[model samples]
Target chain A: MFTGLSAFPLTPFVDDAVDAAAYAGLIERLAASGVDSITALGSTGSYAYLSLEERSRVARLAVAHAGATPVHVGVGALRTSHVLENVRSAEAAGASGVLLAPMTYQPLTPDDVFQLFATVADATELPVIVYDNPGTTHFTFTTELYGRIAQLPGIASVKVPALPEGDAAASDRMAQIRAALPDHVTVGISGDASAAAGLTAGCDAWYSVIAGTLPEVALRIARAAQSGDRDAALQASAELQPLWNLFSTMGGSLRVTAAIAELLGLVAPRSLPLPILGLTAAQRAEVARVSDELGLGG
Target chain B: MFTGLSAFPLTPFVDDAVDAAAYAGLIERLAASGVDSITALGSTGSYAYLSLEERSRVARLAVAHAGATPVHVGVGALRTSHVLENVRSAEAAGASGVLLAPMTYQPLTPDDVFQLFATVADATELPVIVYDNPGTTHFTFTTELYGRIAQLPGIASVKVPALPEGDAAASDRMAQIRAALPDHVTVGISGDASAAAGLTAGCDAWYSVIAGTLPEVALRIARAAQSGDRDAALQASAELQPLWNLFSTMGGSLRVTAAIAELLGLVAPRSLPLPILGLTAAQRAEVARVSDELGLGG
Candidate 1:
């Protein structure tokens, strides 16, 4: 039921409290844009920072804002029970599906990894989207692991966050994965860079983080790729390319999102969680240059 | 003042109920064998499996058993608030210190890693031990991080789980760490294999897991190390080396400890949190072969 452009927004926190009013405002703004669904509590949202009560509030708030669109909750935790708790809270708060990553604390073998997803799928009524971002989880869902998790009953999609920013190994991996999996299990592009190439390689959705701040442009880019308008997709990508320089680094990935969230008056970049260090003075200058180049402030 | 073998016992669950009597028996046995202190709610104790209430019970149970000896509670959590709550609970139960790892979900820079320790230290009056076992946290404390964390008030020791099983890098890291830090703040070995070499590299203690199962022998080994009796220490290590081999694979470390706790009739391994998978039958055979060689099993 989920397709097209999806925005993973930086969750707003005011004095360590879930800023519901800010969330309501952000939700209202994203809904007015052409974004399809809202991935609530994505890593960008500082989902781990939210307590069960806060997650329940945001899940409900996002669902309420999206109206008819699906609201997906990022429900990965250090342990299984923690994720299950997130799932239960997500369900109670009216989420349509969940995006789960493997145990962040320990790396699991393919069998254990499969069992984890199977257990969650068996427990929930909602369709699950398995998040395969090896960078965070420390273990990649290898093609073998992917083929197996594909057979999981409620899994509707695999959001492979590995991008083809034109690396040979990455390209080969996506192609190998594309050839092995069936179509019903949608292969979407996460961090959705090189979107045209991903579409050509067989991605079904453009799951973009920048989509949160630039929904109309994201949607246009995705549609152009989907319809084989390579020229249009290229134009949109070039306009979007300026921001890539700022967002591709470890710090920028976090800072610019929080910065944009702030520029749009969403959330300050200073307050997000771990490994995401704050921006340095040079990084701030780079972000400003990119923002001005794209006329993003306007 | 935490040093020597502070054994972490598993919590036995019978028919889904906590076996307080069995637990009491386990603690009494550790005390009799002369463990320096008891460490409860660690990965070995299946602390992750326990709810907050269960964790509090385990801490209180261990503290009561130790009497004069101190207990160090494992208090690492993904959120700072959770860590604070755990510290409060552990402190109320008479824990002497906390074994705090870096933030769980997000990759943290060394600065934020320092912040996690500082924040937890602020929440409790107890001494804190800085943990750098990247096997769980995915990020290790640089020697710089170790030096800074060691300087923080109440940081009694630094634990590095990477030990050389003849690997020169492990030995090198240990020696480098020892040379960088002050003598008042002891460096302990968390990697079981490093017991001898860690001490050789200037570490003061072995944060031994197998000690929970074979406290008498474990104590003998550690005492030998402390008293500079290398022959006795090696003999003791050779005796318990079988148990370590069982939990040495990809995700085996904690599960093996909890299982050995069960083998010694201290706690049930099955009580471990859901996502915490156990070693396979083949791995268990390795544990058994080692145990048989050591004459540990009747």
Candidate 2:
């Protein structure tokens, strides 16, 4: 159904190679914690940075470790052919579905965006989740575009980032998109902080970053929101607000999540690509304070 | 001294593979028409869409066909390590220099931008041409960042897209960037339509698109502008304005240039990636009319 909390696990690296054992452990932990699904090779997973062979390896490892939980692999690339190749690899690796984002160096028109998704969908029997991440791709998909995309065979869901805090216009727009899209197309909210509001507004699921490392907390909030327990959901959301603030202030969650994962000994210490450094001592202290207050790490 | 008219050759495709013979012929035509240099795999060449091995093959073929003209290869990638790999391949391919743009899915800070270029520059002996194409890369380099990048060991030139039509502010900004950069760093202007104004404003070279297919005419305008013959340069530019208007109206030059090249039989018919199809019938007609008026093709 593509609903409930889907955890996006970080791809742990050791000496620039994918740390297979640590990665499998992370997936196992998420599954044990009751996440509905696992999305590997997401933005936090450094999908774009990994080589083709490495991505294929990660996809296979994630599927193997996920056990009963379905794993959705990101198959985005600048070229459609490369993306198709990734999709084939995911299928071979036994991935449950594929997440597609329109990534290009050029400014792609709406027609271009449709063509990319349509071509990909035509090539794969696996369910496709359309990812609308304008912040990274610099390409925005209108509700009109989404409606058209939903008509494509095998396109079963969409992952939309929550609007900025307190933008009523954006909230209204999300509602409009939900109403316009086919009832069969599940719409999930992304961005850790937006989960509370997005759920209250009737999004089908929360594609969570924090859930990757702290699945129990994320699942509590999602379950509360799903059952219409506003108070419980908001209370859990408030508990994680400190961590969310760090993610927002840090420009992205990848480095902060990686740092937190390392601090808690969830993964081995490894270097990220240049220009994306780990958290500083001050940031690490702040994370520790938040984690301790929330009893996140054992 | 990577100055004057640098033609960015299109990577011709046949049966979904790089058409090596047609590609060689395109490079030969550009060099024969007196281009100052040839930049293979530039935006016009669809560098982002090509595989690593294909890019290497194109780089080697370009250098071979360039004769005495310098060949510069695009080395932009999501990972710094990949860029370094490409830089090494370009050097091995005998490319004279490398063009680099900061390409990442995440928004990069100025410090991140500096580190990307610094690391690439440190790894190569080839002169680096800093490409500031905000349209494609979605990353803008401030003049301050350029100042820092210019101080790097191997950086020798900067390619700035010409300001939008009638944007005096952007022209002034280019001047500011030129003044801010080290004296040894040459500044060139891109966007075929902007050549006249960019040259009149003192940019050292015209990194051109049309020049790849219609090098004789592009070179005429550039040479006239270089010799301080503003009247001749503007007159030549006026002749190309109809074509320029098409480029502006259509949003980018890749499809337009591809259609024109095919119309003129400059290269064999080729396929672009889905979502980036060649110009439509109406667009092709406009291109043919403009090309005919400019005496670009038989």
Candidate 3:
């Protein structure tokens, strides 16, 4: 369930509320796509911007519309109690797994993060993926801390950030992380642009943002790498370099992904939560132009 | 209202609930301590770990019990709408000012942070304090960015983290920040250990975490500096070097302050929110010995 491309969809909004119909459509689309799993309420989903009720509803909606695909729900919150509540909500919503990031305001020590993971792992029956996206959560996990957390019960996966650029370096990085954890915990790669390199470097999964909206394209790269066609995987990713550039320069993937979604008519224009003004009109036009040139929009 | 000693009280918890009796007692104590102001929901108050309802209740309680001392509420949230809601709550609670940290989950751009403060400044009648606590928020503010935000309407104060060790270096740092803002916007200093140096270096306010627990001692330092008695202020701070050393070595001031509160019988033992284990018993006893030696328990 944790292997291959885990598509993370945006939880689109309308008039300051979760656009349930639009969100359900997204899940149904992901369910139709042959990705390994569907992860809802990821950073791409703007989980941090939502209320508890909204998060719970999003979790339930993801499960209900995902069809036969396993759904992993992001259950990160600033408080351990809130994270546990989110985990319970995910469990009740019938999620197959939970992604836990050490969401922080206070600068967290390694022990603080380990304790947070330990507490959640103790409370939940579901498999936990250590969500290590320092870009959003601002809590970096050391390899030693990763080893400590993976030793805890129910930590089934470790979703690491981008790998080093070259294949040898990326592989060396992956090997270092793998040596730190037990064999059962799969290592998944995030950072959409680095997916092909990471996949070719032997990461078990691509925990992806781009795959959520444009599944066929991400699937092309993932399948090529998984089937040992490294050139094809790299080629597929290289074709979408424009989109990756947008993600890097324009703050992060969330707003640009929202722009792409809006362009494709997959979600409402200006669908992101407030304070996150999705993208400038010119930026959206650039995204549309790049996305169209690459035949991303069907 | 933003000058002198602005005490940041801990919102102590017992059995994972906000101990209202203990919190109110803290506010009443600060109110009678001749401190310039009382700031509720600052990092010392554990604002990020609280729910909206709990935060609103704490805001109201601070206003209700602060007597004649002006009360400032930290009205920061991950979402803009939620931050506006907190600002509205503080205004309705009769708070004199609101502290706005660009509390982030998704790393914000300078534009995003500026827009956040602008939006909040527009929405509320209460004056805004630009909370620049990089240690907690993981968002560092540039002097240029400070100039930009201070230009926004209703931004009254800037709560900076810490200053350099030497008096001359701290004074230069203060001058650099002062040059970035308008004449009306006051600069307050946080970081309990740096309060004396910051105050002596011409910071308008000492946003003291220790002051929240031990107002008289903070007042002694703050008053000495404000009255141009720099030697007295430095001497007073030097006398409590043990307490300052504990804060430096023990994660931060919150745990040490909580330990001191527990030792002083100001709040219930083990009062911090879950996942933030206050301190080991040995650490707590160390705080006790230091506080007792400094005559901080009285």
What residue runs in model 2 are displaced by over 4 Å at the alpha carbon? A163-171, A278-282, B163-175
DockQ-derived CAPRI band for the predicted complex in model 3: medium
Tens-digit lDDT string for candidate 2 (A134-201): 98888988888999999998988999988656647557867788877888899989988878888877
Candidate 1 vs candidate 2, lDDT winner? 2
* Highest-DockQ candidate: 3
* Segments in model 3 whose C-alpha atoms lie over 4 Å from true places: B165-168
The per-residue C-alpha lDDT of model 3 at residue A288 equals 82
How would you encode candidate 1's per-residue C-alpha lDDT over B169-222 as one tens digit per residue?
A: 666776788777877787778766557666655567677666666777567778
- TM-score for each prediction? 0.91, 0.95, 0.96
Of candidate 1 chain A, the 10-residue stretch with the lowest lDDT total is A268-277
**Per-residue lDDT of A1-298 in model 3, one digit per residue for the tens?**
8899999999999988999999999999988988999999999999998999999999999999999999999999988889988998999999999998888876677877899999999998999999998877777888989999999999999999999988789989999999999999999999999999999999999999988998998999999999999999999999889889998888889989899899888999889887777688888888888888888885
TM-score of chain A, model 3? Answer: 0.99
i-RMS for every candidate (Å) is: 3.1, 1.7, 1.4
Model 2's DockQ? 0.62
Clashes of each: 2, 0, 0
C-alpha displacement of B42 in model 1, angstroms?
2.7
Which wins on lDDT, candidate 1 or candidate 3?
3
The lDDT for every candidate, in the order shown, is 0.72, 0.85, 0.90
